[model samples]
Target chain A: AQSVTQLDSHVSVSEGTPVLLRCNYSSSYSPSLFWYVQHPNKGLQLLLKYTSAATLVKGINGFEAEFKKSETSFHLTKPSAHMSDAAEYFCVVSDRNGNEKLTFGTGTRLTIIP
Target chain B: GAGVSQTPSNKVTEKGKYVELRCDPISGHTALYWYRQSLGQGPEFLIYFQGTGAADDSGLPNDRFFAVRPEGSVSTLKIQRTERGDSAVYLCASSLMVGGRDEQFFGPGTRLTVL
Candidate 1:
């Protein structure tokens, strides 16, 4: 079975400060991971994904995550937080072996303080 | 269209009524997926369709929920006797299936409220 866990339920960062939201995963096969953000009342948007090619993946809005096999972690980070960054973030995992259905973590709600 | 699209941005229904949500995947994409997101929770997998066939549906909560992709592009999720607990945002996504990367682009979602 494939599953994902977002280590933090909530994370708050002041504007212009660094931000971090941690995630972990478990998969039987080589895993494909992704980070997505959902702004209030809007569609979920893809931030980035790791398909086993590059350990570090960069995404929209100056976000990035490193795929750490040894740690079973795929943590999302940003150099600076903006007020618009306040939203819900999800960590998803899918393996090549099955139908590639995504397994999602509960989610981490990020709060940006001005 | 460039991205996935879903209809009925919001729906309010009485308990036990039936509802149908629609999704239009990105053009030329062969894989489509359905998910449901409750308040404060991440989206949960509901089903997957490869072309015109349902490849996986293990995540469906019960038989009351069903989905179909008739022509391999537009899909509809059907619900029977909707309950209050069934209220959620139904999300649809499509994958290009390029090199098996499986990165899915999502739709705005159909918010269903069962009262």
Candidate 2:
């Protein structure tokens, strides 16, 4: 069984400040992790993915996440926050052995203050 | 060139009625998926299709839910005897045939309201 847990349901950050959205996971097998962003009334967009390559992964729009196997975490981070970055973020995990089913976290809602 | 598209952005129906939602995947994408998302929760997997066959339907809640991808490009999800609990956003996603590394592209999703 594989599951993901997002520590924060909502996070607020001021513009130009650093942003952090924490996520943790439990997987029996080697897992593939992904971060997806969803704006209001829009579809989910892939931000980044980790497939047992580098521990640190960079994504679109200045977002990045570090895969820590020891901690069972893959927390998303950004050096600076922008207004457009306010959205819902989901942490997903899947099996590495060709399992296409993605187990998604409850999601973290990000709010950016001007 | 285009991304995944799902038909009927919104659907409202009375309980016990049947409904069908459709999805058109991106060109050349061989893997399609269906999920249901309730408010304040992440999407729950319903089914997955590889090419024209359903690779996995274990996530489906019950026999009332069925899906078909006759030609491997377009797919349909049919739900029978709808209940108020069935109200949720139905999402469709597609990915290239790259096994575990495929990054899924999602559609806007259909908002179903069961009355």
Candidate 1 on A46-109: residue-level lDDT in tens? Answer: 8998887889999999999999999999999999999999999999998873236888899999
- Give a tens-digit lDDT track for model 1, residues B1-115: 5889999999999999999999999999999999999988889999999899998899899999999999999999999999999999999999876337756889999999999
lDDT of 1 at B107: 96
**DockQ (model 1, Cα):** 0.55
In model 2, the clashing pairs are: none
Tell me how much of the true interface, by contacts, candidate 1 captures: 0.51
Candidate 2: tens digits of C-alpha lDDT, residues A8-103: 999999999999999999999999999999999999999999999999999999999999999999999999999999999999999765349899
Which pairs, if any, clash in model 1?
none
Model 1 Cα shift for residue A108 (angstroms): 1.0
Report how far residue A55 has shifted in candidate 2, in Å. Answer: 0.7
Cα error, residue A56 of model 1, in Å, equals 1.5
Off by over 4 Å in 1: A97-99
In candidate 1, residue B25 scores what lDDT? 94
